[model samples]
Target chain A: MHEHQEPTPETFSTPVLSTTTATATAVAAEAAVPGAMLATPANESTTAQSLSTASQEPRQGEPTAQSNEIQLTDEQILTQMQAIKDEEANAHPLVDNSVDLTELEKEYENGSQAFKNKIKNLSDTHDRMRRSRGDGNCFYRAIAFAWFERVMLAKTKPELYTHAIKAMEESKDLLLAAEFEPLAFEDFYAVTLETLESVPTSTPEALLTAFQTDEISNSIVMHFRLVASAYLKTHQEDYAPFLEFGQTMDEYCSMHVEAMGRESEEMMLIALTKAMHIGIEVAYLSGNQSADEVNFLPFSPDTEPYMPPLVLLYRPGHYDILYRKSHCLEGVV
Target chain B: MAKPMFARRLSKELKDLAMNPPAGVDIIDANDFKVWKLGLAGAPGTLYEGEKFQLEFNFGPNYPLESPQVLFVGDNVPIHPHIYSNGHICLDVLYNHWSPVQTVASICLSLQSMLSSCTSKERPPDNANYIKTARANPKHTAWAFHDDTV
Candidate 1:
């Protein structure tokens, strides 16, 4: 048994992050097919940054590698990729440095009974899951559900609800098996928004517009407009200019900003919460989407023209097959 | 003070757990914010039965963003091929598939369910040699765990 489980002081927490482990883990990664470089911090950082900027800019000059057809078998690339990720992990801090749970604890302590009680429960649940070694379990699912309920419940503010709903719907479409191309976005947006307007309150009708997009249902283009309008309203402080415009629904959805008032790590949490809401709505809407459509990308700010409408395509058998193949590559499960 | 949004989200998880504790879970260590020990009752319809298991969790500075590393502890550590003698569990959601959306109770319940669902009681095929090698060169020797059945 090793006496010291922690890394040495020289390496500290940040430096000893396994650069090589990223490669090793990339090899170990389930969805990550071969030909993709091991997930180094540098690689992820650059990729994540590009993804952020790309979200802003239109899909104009960037080379859409028509060679997306290049295929590297999972097995052949696993070893080299894992080695690379492992190396990357060894060198860079894989996690953000700005989290201070202690402060959160203090805040909870000083807050309202409902607030403190609510927070303490979450903390306690988190603690229990950790101790139980229940990493991949229902504890995660339950938490996800709770987060979803809370956000939806807090939908008293219309704009927040609208933004949250639209974002959630888009995520649902992406994670579900059936594909809705960018061409479908405008139609989806228009009809969905008109239906949302018809709903006097936050009702199931609003939910219906998200997944069921037929004639008796609503036009997809109208759907996008209503949802985008709600989003613009909810985030008025950040998106005031866009709200003023009679801009196209695509133009409205295209505007991206650095998630305000939070560190990058926290931003991930917000994104995750948002993703859960998307999943919940999908489930309620009887849409085929899964929770994976939540944008799990890291944060980086940039100035660029907005990209064309992008859609998430959900693949049902992908995750399990990917998990199995990933284990095979690492020669470990 | 305006509560940080993440904290509010975390709070929501706690409320749900208290209202609905999964079938066989007990929080052993409640005071320490970072260290948690959970007790899982043997799940029904699986290999783990009438046996109690312990799991330990260590949260990082970035609590929600970074998932806690979990280790199975105590004598009941399953002798399955996938599980090592030491309680370190190798599951993806704990690391890579981890999203801040998941809460502690959900994770434990999932583990409990997985434990109950186990059909085989054997360690991974290479367990013996890996254990032997790990005894001396713990850091360098990585266990090549390979088994889908268990």
Candidate 2:
């Protein structure tokens, strides 16, 4: 959390000397976070400061330096501060496994009854919320984090890893059958397979660290997106009714499902979970009147004897990993 | 350390294209996986019949996630209403409509059909002005693909 905190002006002074070193340090700092990498420092203010300082040099006919300083209105300053805060939030890891649910309650203290009730319900079933960044990719990131964590915890059961690998490998055929070019999707699929296969050999600490790496994590998420897209395309007839705003299945998938960084919707979750043969329980915590008692909506319900269900906490526009007390001890006890 | 993912996918595509290429399409240069050159022949029974053109594809490190930079090059560029004199094509599939499922072969087939469906042979209306101010890469241009009736 300290790494995600906004860096003070003094912290910026040291890194400002070398742009290359600043970038390297930023990457390292992000890796230090729990699940995701730290966000890169915003270079806007630094650039603005340098330019202003350069322009402040006294000229023969120019007025005194006091007149050249720009003054920002209160509204402008507030907007700028809000923008910085948003950037800091975005830079936080895609998933934080130790976030307490009380923070969420605090966020809604001044809100309506629906929000308070939602939080109360969430607190009953979930003790902590593993936050995912609010970027459009939160759903994929959250799911991937859960999958990787499961693999690390279930290392003794090699069959789980093997099954995940088989599922990923089989997804290639689905994408190809859906008329996706093998060349376009093979790279993403291959990276996903590599990550899945490595889970058995790597230490749990190493596996966790790998997910924090942007290149590896993003590739895995991209592969999941492809799987979801292929599932929707193959079952277009079954899911077409859910398409909103008169968008054809192809148009919807192209615009939202297939495109990188696009958020997932209900149809996507259903199709993706069904395709992977894994069940997901999403506890919706929205402020809508309809949201009550942390409704646990199941995606792809399963009846397997040993299949561990993936649980997630869903707010209005974002998703986070969730852990139940009993399930968390299955690996150790 | 090495970019195995990009290299592997591009090589596989090159192999597939070589083994079975679509009609009138040929791979010109594929030694460098990051950049490729392709040759396309105008479809028969169309305005561009008997014409030939070359296309350049430059892929960034983030290759499938990001759309490739594609454009026509060489002297015999096609003259279509949606094509600029500078060899920029105004097709939606190449830009905003791009999906990760699309491959080099698919794009080539698309350009072939774009040529086949043309009723006339002419540059876009603002060809000269666009060519003058356009950046080196067509991907940078904010093209408005309003006219799909071409």
Candidate 3:
């Protein structure tokens, strides 16, 4: 018999869509059946279901494409339910103590239209809860990509699938920077599958090209893959799942390491050339030096003509090849 | 030149702070470049009245672009449910809502205001068990910040 009142000013800005849906689903599910899925589902299950439902519903006032590409994987959906069940059993504390949820469930079932109103009233309160938990536009994007991944995988649309992958590649920085890591994986998986769909069936070149341009993140990734590939070649028996999630980062790291190894002698010559060229104080060199630091000197066009010693060093065979190639790939550096 | 870029910007920010420090706040560590510590006074007419709290601010190489890891220091930790015993705040702005514009002063002020307006001196009901055991990992534990009846 608590009277309805507007939420306080402090909590007006919390992200509510996921909270409302999650709460409504929980209450609705409870109203429909009590003690359901009680065999100890994991915490990830609730987040997955919340994420899946988010994918289905369009944002208010904005019409989302009926993207069949996005659907929650069976594993993801199950994870959501299990997580909710765990939360209910283990973390029994709720912010509102006025009406007990267990009591409210019975009250809601027994012709309490007021209960529905209560649900609606508390919607705003939960919205802030969601926002505070790091749900935002990025979260929505993850859900959307998750949906896209499921639907496209289900139907096999190469174009939309590839587009989705590219979308993920573009949005990776956004996904990575988020505090919520679980959703990031789902989004990343969707994009990877989508990007895989876009690759032409016959050519690894097409795959390499896609990785080079639109999927430059994949370049860093490819470096990791190259490293892993090399590792596998050397230590095939001891393969680890750590780098199995995706090849992009592993590949990128491996390639950079390989490149530095190959260019070390040239790098030293370049550092010597730069010291002679610019005459810029080569102040003590106190810290741990990296290959990229020395690599910068000989290849830098601005510093090249200034040093006659550098020009002489650069006039050689490998140095000439390295300089020409470096200049060509100037933007990348 | 790269050193000057950071040095100049930091100096400018320091000068700006000297001219107009946030209300009842003090910026310390003008000499050391690594550690930036600021002091906060609890806001009046609230639970945290007349208390002085200090916050430690650490800046990484990516200044402004990356948010500072701010933590409440010393004994007067605000007894909020969301705050960790180790003084790590669970506020979204300190991590996710963190904009580049928010200075050490502004963050200290926000925390001060958040403390001053508190009607309850208790932690969230789940805080005792959750905070006790949840120290294992902050990232994995999903804190339900949804208390409406407060």
Winner on lDDT between 2 and 3 is 2
Q: How close is candidate 1 to the true structure, as a TM-score?
A: 0.35
Please identify which of the two predictions, 2 or 3, would achieve the higher TM-score against the true structure.
2
**Candidate 1: residue A47 lDDT (0-100):** 24
Alpha-carbon deviation at A262 in model 2, angstroms: 1.7
- Per-prediction interface RMSD? 16.4, 17.5, 17.7
Each model's lDDT comes to 0.35, 0.65, 0.36
| TM-score head-to-head 1 vs 2, winner | 2
DockQ of each candidate relative to the true complex? 0.01, 0.16, 0.01
- Model 3 CA lDDT for position A71: 43
After aligning candidate 3 to the native by TM-score, how far in Å is the CA of A211 from where it should be?
Answer: 19
Q: How are the candidates ranked when ordered by TM-score, highest leading?
A: 2, 1, 3
Q: Write the per-residue lDDT of candidate 2 for residues A169-221, one digit (tens) a residue.
A: 77888888788766777677776788787877777667656666656776778
Please give me the DockQ of candidate 2 compared with the native complex: 0.16
Backbone clashes in candidate 2 total 1
Ranking by lDDT: 2, 3, 1
lDDT of 3 by residue, A47-166 (tens): 333423211111112222233434444345436545543443233211111222233234345333545454334332221111111111112121222222232333334444444354
True contacts kept of each: 0.00, 0.23, 0.00
The superposed Cα distance between candidate 1 and the true structure at residue A50, in angstroms, equals 14
What would the per-residue lDDT of candidate 1 be over residues A191-308, giving only the tens digit for each residue? 4444444444544434332322223121332232233233333444654442335644223333221111111112222233333233211111001223222222222223221111
